[model samples]
Target: MATVTTRTVEYPADGLTMIGHLALPAGVERRPAVLIGPEGLGLSDVERRRADALAELGYVALAFDIHGGRYLGDPQEMLARCMPLLADPDRMRGIGHAALDVLRAEPRADPGRIAAIGYGTGGAIALELGRDGVDLRAIGTVNAVTTGRPGEAARIRCPVWAGVGSEDPIMPPAQRDAFTAEMQAADVDWRLVVYGGALHAFHHPPVDHAVVSGVGHHPRHAQRAWRDIVDLLAECLPISG
Candidate 1:
C-alpha cells in the first residue's frame, strides 16, 4: 500500500470556519478525489480514518466538516444545529461547495475526477451538491437519503448510490420512497440498498460517550455497505492499482 499523508484543513462556510481532515496518496501526481461527509455530529476520527483508507487506495480524500469544528455528542444539540441546515438547500449546498473547493485546491487532487460519499447529515449535503449541478462522477450516502426538490435532481449528471437501514425510523419507508421517486422522476442512474436489520447510523461504531435513539451500529451490514460504496466508486471512477 502507498503511504498516505493526512492533515487538518480549514475553510469558510455559512459565516463560520469549518475544519476538515484531508488525506493524500504518496505521490504528488493528480489522482481522483473523494469528498467524505461525516454524520450529523461532526467530522470524527471515524470519518478521518475513512479518508486515510481512501488515500491508501490511491485517491485523495477529504473528510469535510459540518459543525464548525465541534463534535455534537449530544443528540439534541446535533439536531438543533443540523436540522435547520438540512432543511435549507441553499445552506447545505454552500457547506458542501466550501469543502469541495478545498478538496479541488489540493495539488494532488484531480479536479475533474471527483466523487462524494457521506453519512447522516453529511450524506444529505453530498446529495445537495449533486442536485446543485456539481460535476461529480458518483454520489454515495448512508442513512441519509433526503428527497431533493422537484426538478432539482435533474441537474445531477452522475450515478447516485444510497444505503439505509430498513428499520431506520428517521429515514423510514416513506422517506426512502420519496427519495427514490425523485431520482426516478429525474431519470437519474441510481441504486438503493436497504439493510434488513440495521438502523440509523449503522455504519458508525458504538460511541461509548453518546447514545442516540433509533441509531445503532451493525458491524456486518456496515462492512457490506462499505463494499457497496467501493463498488460504486470503482464502477464510476476507475482506479488502477
Candidate 2:
C-alpha cells in the first residue's frame, strides 16, 4: 500500500518551495533511486516513514525538503533555520545539488541507480552529496557532522556508509577521530558503523522536546541502521528487475 508521490520542488537557491516525497516500487521499471535528506526538523512524519520504508525496498524514494514549508516547533526556531543552512558548506553543496536534481529527474529514476540518504541535518546533507562530486552510486549517513573541509575527504566519489553513535554527543570521539582520519586519507569507499550505546538521533524516534534537539532513540540502532541502509543500497545500486 505504498505508491506515494507528492511534490513541490521550486528551490531556485532560496525561493524555497521544497517538499518532495516520491516512493514508487511496485512493478518497478527503472527503479533504484533514493534521495532522502530530512532531519533538521523539516520533513517530518519520520521522514515520511523513511520514504515509505524505501518504497518497500525496491527503491525509488525521494524525501527532501530543507524547510521551506516551514515547521519549527521552536527548538530555538529549528536551530535558527537549520544552523545557517548547515553553516554553509557551499550552501550544503547547493542543497545537495538541489536534492540530487530532484532524484535524477524522476521518470522512475535510474540515472545509473542513484543513491543518497541522510538524517541529522539530513546527515549533513548526505555528507554534502558525497563531498560534492555527486554522481552518487552510494552514500548513507545517519548521525553526520564533519564539515571541516580540508580537501573535503578528497571529494568522495561514492561508496560511503556511515552510521554513528558511539554515544554521539554530537559526534564525539574526537570528531570521530577526525572523520576517520579524513576518510582514511581520502582513499574513500568508507564505512563507519559504531553504535555502542547509541544516542544522537539514532535513526530518529522519541522526539518531542518541542520537536527534537535531543532525546535519543536507538531501537537496536534503528534496526541495524535499516539493515545497513539496505545493505548499502544493495552494494551500490544493483537491482535490475
Candidate 3:
C-alpha cells in the first residue's frame, strides 16, 4: 500500500461550513482526483476511509461533507435535512460545485481528470453536478439512482455507473427504470448493477444507530460495488506512469 496523508478542510456550501476530508497520495506530482460524497448521514469515518483508500491508490480524493459538520445518526433527522435538499437541484449543484472547486484547487489534483463517486444522498449530488454540466471523466453512485429534471441529463458528458440492491425499497425497480430511461433519452453512456438480495445502503457497514426499514449491510455486494467503481475509474480516468 502507498503512503497516504489526510486533513480536514473547511469550506462554505449550502449556507453551512462544510468540513471535508482531503486525502493525498504518497507522491508530490499532481494526480487524477476523485470526489467522494458521503451518505445522507454526512461525512463519517466510512467515507473518510474511502478517501484515504483512494489516495493510497495514487489518486487525490476529497470526501465532501453533506450536513455541514454534523453526522445525523437518526434516520428521521437525516431525512428531515436531506429531503428538502434533494428536492432542489440548484442547491445540490451549489453544494457539489463548492466541493469540486475545493478539489480542483488542491495542488495534487489534476483538475482536468476527475471523477465523482457518491453514496445515497451524496450520490444524488454527484448526479446533480453532472446535470449542471460539470466536466467529469466518470460518475459512480451506490444506492442513488436518482433521475434528474427533464432534459437535464443531456448535460452529463461522461459515463455514469450506478449500483443498487435488488431488494432496496428506497430505490425500487420503477425508480431504476426511470433513471435509465432518462439516461437513454439523453444518449448518455450508463450502466446499472443490481445486487441480488441486498438492501438499501448495502454498501455501508453495519451501524449502531437506528436505520430505516430495508437498510442493511451486505459485505459481499459492498466489495463488488467498490471493485466496479475502481474499474470505472481505471477505464475512464486512469493513473499514468
lDDT of each: 0.93, 0.77, 0.96
Candidate 1 total steric clashes: 0
The 10-residue segment with the lowest total lDDT in model 1: 232-241
**What's the lDDT for residue 192 in model 3?**
96
Best by TM-score: 3
What C-alpha lDDT does candidate 2 achieve relative to the native structure? 0.77
Tens digits of per-residue lDDT for model 3 on 51-142?
99899888999999988899999999999999999999999999999999999999999999999999999999999999999999999999
Which regions of candidate 3 are displaced past 4 Å?
A: none
Each candidate's TM vs. the true structure? 0.98, 0.32, 0.99
Model 1 TM-score, 2 decimals: 0.98
RMSD of candidate 3 to the truth, in angstroms, is 0.7
Residue 66's C-alpha lDDT in candidate 2? 81
Q: Which residue pairs does candidate 3 place in steric collision?
A: none
Error of 2 at 84 (Å): 37
Best by lDDT: 3
Better of 1 and 3 by TM-score: 3
